[model samples]
Structures are given as C-alpha cells and as structure tokens.
Target: MTTGDRCEMPPIPLRSTPIKGFILDITGVLYNSMEGTDGIPIQGSAHAVNRLYSESRVRFLSNESTGTVGHVVGKLGRLGYTGIREEDVITPAPTAAEYCKRNGLRPHLLVHPGIRSVFDGLSQEDPNCVLIGDAEHAFTFKAINTAFRHLMKMKDPLLLSLGCGKFYQRTDGPCIDVGAFAEALKYSSGCRHVVIGKPRGDYFQTALDSMGLAKDEVVMIGDDIVSDVGGAMAFGMRAIQVRTGKWRSEWESHEIKPTLIADDLLSAVKACID
Candidate 1:
C-alpha cells in the first residue's frame, strides 16, 4: 500500500482476519522498563500475547543496544512471558555484526559490554568502522573522542548507528539515546551514518524477511510514533500505535499515520484479533 492509504484509528471489528505474523516492540508495547521491574502486566497484554503466541508467528523487535538477544529473552521470561526463545528476539547488535561481516569492515564498537559478544568473530585490529549504540555509562566524552580520531584517519570510514532514538524512558526518567551522539559525529566527520534499527526500511525488512511474510501480511505494534509506527507504514506494513512509552499529543500532526491507535498493547492486540 502507498503512504496515502492510511487508516486513522479505525474501530476494532468483532472479528478480523487473523494476522500471519506480528512485529512487536518490547519497550512500551510488551513491558514498561528495560529491567522489567514494573509490577503486573499492562492490563491484558499478557493474555493477548499468550493467545497470539499459539496462532501467529511472533517476533520481538527491540532497539535496545544495552543487551543481547539472550538478555532480552531472559528479561521477558522474568516478566512471565513464556515460550520465547533467543531466535524470537531481534536486536541491532546482530544486525550490525552481519552488516560489518558482509562489507569486510573492521569494527570499533562503542556499545554496552552486554552485547559485545554479538561481534565475537569480527576483527577489531585496524578498526575502520565506528559502530555506536546506547553505551549508557560507557558513553563518555573520551570514548566519543576516541571514535572520532579513528574516523579521521580513514578516507571514508563507516559509521553505524544501532538506533536513532532521541531519548528513552529509563527506570529513573528519560535519558539520551544514541541518536544525539550519532548526529554529533555525522556533523563533525561529514560521514552519514547508516542507521540499523527502527524507522529504517532495512531494519523492518529484516524482521519481515525472517518471518517469510510480505509487508502487507504483517502488522507492527509499538509505542514510538516515528520509529515503530511511521517506519512500519513506510515499509508498507500496517501499524498500530499504543499510547504508552514515548507517546505524545503532537504525533497526530506527523505526516505518517497509524492504521489504528489503541490505549496500550492489549488494546492494540485486541484490535488485531477481534
């Protein structure tokens, strides 16, 4: 479908066609915090997920750069989500690793230690490419300067950003995401960084390809209007926006629209199934 073919917050039907596959965002749609410390499920989210798990191919797509696929799976398990495996989760670390391997670029990683294992086989000797992610405590000025120096030496070095999210809701409050840093480097280095997660066509395409389903056959459910909803819509997939995490009133003014808008993930899934 084209960008003009948008469905704006349509009412949920009594019975709709069962979706073949589902692309779910973890941060807001599935759970609240990264640590899964928030008490209880978001109303009926658990029930909806459990029901869909039996019938549809579900994949958890996250922009979280601090953890590996295994780490995310473990967190989900702790939050009482059953039947989830490592393969069911897709994060930017693996995608970045694959991109670097395919292009024969040596990586200078600026990501969290938790996800460092994703690039295990890759060479880091003469690091020609600088890969940036949400390194949290490790994202010091020294680290950024170090990466900048490495980029200056190469004629056209690669800069890979895991996600370009402006900020994320942490346990305490909202915190800066990798996008800010990525933009800074882009301005300084004059190198356009290739974003590997959310809102990027290739990122959504990767998830769809893994499920072996066409874009039209799948639906993307998430809270971020730009990355999750707008990105999926741009990729020709139906999207549902949940009013949870980083949702704002100004999202309605954006050019890209969601097929439906639900109160939360449970409501969004209910719109999908019923």
Candidate 2:
C-alpha cells in the first residue's frame, strides 16, 4: 500500500528533528499479536515502513519472544512489509544466545516454543544461566518455581531477560509479557537480571550499532511510553509515540516527552520525512 492510498487522519504537527535512522517496535507499532501474519496491519504501517526503508536505514526492533529472527522477517513479508531481512530485525533471543556463548554459560531457556530455535546449540543440561522470554504456554507456576530452584543452586548464575515489557496488545486485549515473570524470578532468587530488550541500554545500543549512526541521529517510534519512548529518549535517541495498541491517555503526564505524537506509524514517518 502506498501513502496516497491511505485514509486520511488528522495532521500531526511536524518536528524539525533530523533523523538518519529509525528503530521501530514491531508488535504494537507495525503489527499486533492478534492474527500473526494473517493479522490486520496497522493502517499505513506498511507504507510508512517501506518509505522509511527507501529513505534511510530502518531496523525492526521488537521485544516479542514468539518467533526467531527468520520467522519475524518472514512474517513481516507476509504482512506486506518489504525489503526487510534477518539483519534488519533485532530481538532478544539472538542477543541472549550470543551473550551466553561469549561467557560460556549454559542457558536454561524459558521462552516460547516457537522461538527456542534461536538457542538451538546452547546448553540446557544443568544450566548455569537462566534466560527468560515470553514463554506463553510454558509460564506456569511450576515452570517459574523450577527456574527459581535452578537459580538458587547455581553459583552467581546469570539471569537474562529478553524483554521487561509489562504487557503486549492482542486482538482480545492486553496480554501479560515475560517481564512480570522475569521479575518474579528475580525477586525470589535475588539475582539482578540483565535485561537485553527495550527500556535497557543494551537493547538500544544493539540497534544503534547496527545502523552505525549516532544516537542523536536516530528516532524510535513505538506505542509504549515507558519502554519505547522513555527508553529511547534515555538512550539519547529522539522518540515518536503513536496512539495505537497499548497507548494510554495517562502517558502524557509522564516526564519523558516524545519528539512528536502521531495518530499512527504513517504520521510518525511523515513527521520524519516531510
């Protein structure tokens, strides 16, 4: 879909802030968890993302733990987003795997079954590290207690969190993410988690490093104020908040102001481009 084909929305006041690169959140900004690839695209999201790709470096940064990098790229293509590759996307799975390999730590992965492929070669037997992601069906009380028990026995065990997002938007409503579970484990085990996703410096740094651009030259567009806007702004990147998915009126009262507020992703891109 092209920009001209989109139904008109109210104009958002443009910002003069120069943006050389873009870090876009996948679930709430470009798509939601309702129908996966068959899900409805946020209006003009595909168009905006395509346009931005044509103009500058754009990275699909998502905290979603449902799929591997390849799966995410395929899903985007199936949903009409073009020109995205494995390298164009960043998620906590691969990042966590790399960290584990670098430190020679065994991972006790507590992620969704769909995304476990990211840690195919990692050690799971008598793991010395605990890595948590949105485990969906696997996040039962038994699982949490088992992970907590494992952490208690290890010496300085590593606790890695892919995302600390409180909730994600779904077709039905907001669904709890792995962040709540991760926190529970942290509280019980008394191990400080190394958060590798949004609202953390490492997550922003990974995206910034991929673009090879200064933080000041990049803009993050997302729906969550705390994770997307506040996180990016804290990392020195300008942020644009979109009133879609999990956005709330109460976010405006927060101290972390976005560079611009738009009705949707298309408007956010227009502010950056036009």
The 0-to-1 C-alpha lDDT of every candidate, in the order given, reads: 0.81, 0.83
Report how far residue 226 has shifted in candidate 1, in Å: 1.4
lDDT of model 1 at position 264: 88
**Per-residue alpha-carbon lDDT of candidate 2 for residues 127-207, written as tens digits (9 for 90 to 100):** 998999999878988888888988999888568888788988888888888889988988888886888789887789899
> 105-144, model 1: which lDDT tens digit per residue?
8989888888988899999998988999999889899999
148: Cα error in model 1, Å: 1.0
TM-score of each: 0.90, 0.90
Candidate 2, superposed: residue stretches over 4 Å from native: 1-17, 35-37
Question: What C-alpha lDDT, on a 0 to 100 scale, does residue 11 get in candidate 1?
Answer: 34
Flag regions of model 1 displaced more than 4 Å.
1-18, 34-41
